[model samples]
Target: MVYQRARDQAELSAIQEAYHLVSKRMEGVPGLLGNELLRSAHDPSGLVVMSRWSDLAAFQAWEQGSEHRADTAPLRPYQDTRMEIPFGVYEVDAAY
Candidate 1:
């Protein structure tokens, strides 16, 4: 079970919009396992995503797909206010 985490900030409304897009559209895409959007209780502007894919390739394909691009278009306007500060990603090794 490999996971990818993307940390970004957006208005509650935009987060809601993006959330729907992923739930509806991403599920149909190949290689998607599941994903969720998490908001910081301390900071509304802080948004974190926990996504699982069949594997890294599947995740990369989704990232490069048009569905991801188009769905995220709505987030452009608020880039300044609702953007992640600096994020890090770590790999999870495969289990035996």
Candidate 2:
């Protein structure tokens, strides 16, 4: 997942909406999983986005996929991002 910053409330909301809708399109991909978005309590402009995929390849494929490209419709109108940072990637080693 990654954390991105927006310039203001409007931009932050747009990013959140975009991410939410985009994930739905990613549902059937191989190794597909789920994700979450968080706004910093201290700074609401800070967004934390975490996405889980079947694997790195799956994630990469999604990034390069055409469907993923189309999902940008919600964000194209708003150039609302300030900065983005990769928080971390966790591998599913063991789970129930």
Candidate 3:
């Protein structure tokens, strides 16, 4: 998940646009199952781009690839800088 903050509605729109572009670029990418753009109910400026991959190995492979930075650059400026780490990776322990 990548945490993001949009100061206002205009910024939010831009973020959404960027998300869509990134999604398009990721189409058919190996191991990328799906992704979502989530906005906070309490704090409208708070946003998160969550992507599901087949496994850690797959995600790491893409992240380390040459196109990774360019593909995700659009949202870089909006990343939540307050947190020490603005992103995280997790494995499902249990799911219904």
Candidate 4:
């Protein structure tokens, strides 16, 4: 997951637009399944971006790629200034 806290409504709009562009880029990525952007009800500026991929290797490849860097550059400012922005990778140990 990725978290964002924009400085204001304008920044939030920009962040959303940047995420839209990044999501578009992810659409054709080799093993990317899909992704969702969720906004916090309590804080309009807070956002959570979650993505799914075919495997850890696939995700890692994308994470380390130049294309990913280019795609997410627009979000760097907000990401850098945000508080409590947590990132992680988890094993899908169980499924319904």
Candidate 5:
């Protein structure tokens, strides 16, 4: 997940637009299951782009690839700088 913070409504709209464009660009990418854009109820400026992959290797492969930075550049400016690490990785340990 990548944390994002928009300074105001205009920036928030831009963030959402960028997220959708990125999502479209990522369609059919190998090992990418899907992704979602989430908003915080308490803090409307807060947002997250959470993506699911088939495995860690798949995600790492994409992250380290040449297109990674270019593909996500649109959203880089809004990354939550307040957090020491604005992103995280996790694997499913259990399922219902």
Candidate 6:
């Protein structure tokens, strides 16, 4: 997951735009299942990005690729923290 906080409204707009652009580019990428962009209800400036891939190798390859780096460059400054999981620590035992 990716987490970021914008300093102001303008920064938030930029952040959203950047993520949209990147998400658009991610379309048709092999092994990529889907992605979601979310904002915190309590903290409007906070954001979370989640991406689903077919497997760990697919995610790793994309993470190390130039496109991912380029796409995420604008977001580096606004990022407060990030968490990357290599394996499924928690599984969906029940999804209704």
Top candidate on lDDT is 3
Positional deviation of residue 28's Cα in model 5 after best superposition, in angstroms: 1.9
> Taking the tens digit of each residue's C-alpha lDDT, what string does model 2 give over 1-96?
565677777777778788777677666766667777777899866676677776888877777887765864654444324544344567788999
RMSD of 2: 3.8
Return the lDDT, model 3, position 18. 94
Q: How many residue pairs clash in each candidate?
A: 1, 1, 0, 0, 0, 0
Worst 10 residues of 1 by lDDT: 1-10
Task: Please state the error at residue 75 of candidate 2 in Å.
Answer: 4.2
Alpha carbon lDDT of residue 34, candidate 4? 90
Rank list by lDDT: 3, 5, 4, 6, 2, 1
Relative to the true structure, candidate 3 reaches a TM of: 0.95
Residue 71 in model 2: lDDT: 61
On residues 1-96, what C-alpha lDDT tens digit does candidate 6 reach at each position? 678777799988988888888788789888889877788899887787777788778878887887877766776777754335311222346888
For candidate 2, list the clashing residue pairs, or say none. 31-54
What's model 5's overall lDDT? Answer: 0.92
Q: Give the winner by TM-score.
A: 3
Task: Indicate the TM-score of model 2.
Answer: 0.61
Assess each prediction's global lDDT (C-alpha) against the native: 0.57, 0.68, 0.94, 0.79, 0.92, 0.74
Q: Candidate 4: misplaced stretches above 4 Å?
A: 80-86
Backbone clashes (count) for model 1: 1
Q: How do the residues 19-67 of candidate 5 rate in per-residue lDDT, one tens digit apiece?
A: 9888888888789999999998998888999999999999999999998
Candidate 6: regions farther than 4 A off: 81-96
Q: In candidate 6, how many Å is residue 11 off?
A: 1.0
In model 5, which regions exceed 4 Å deviation? none
Instruction: Output the TM-score of candidate 1.
Output: 0.60
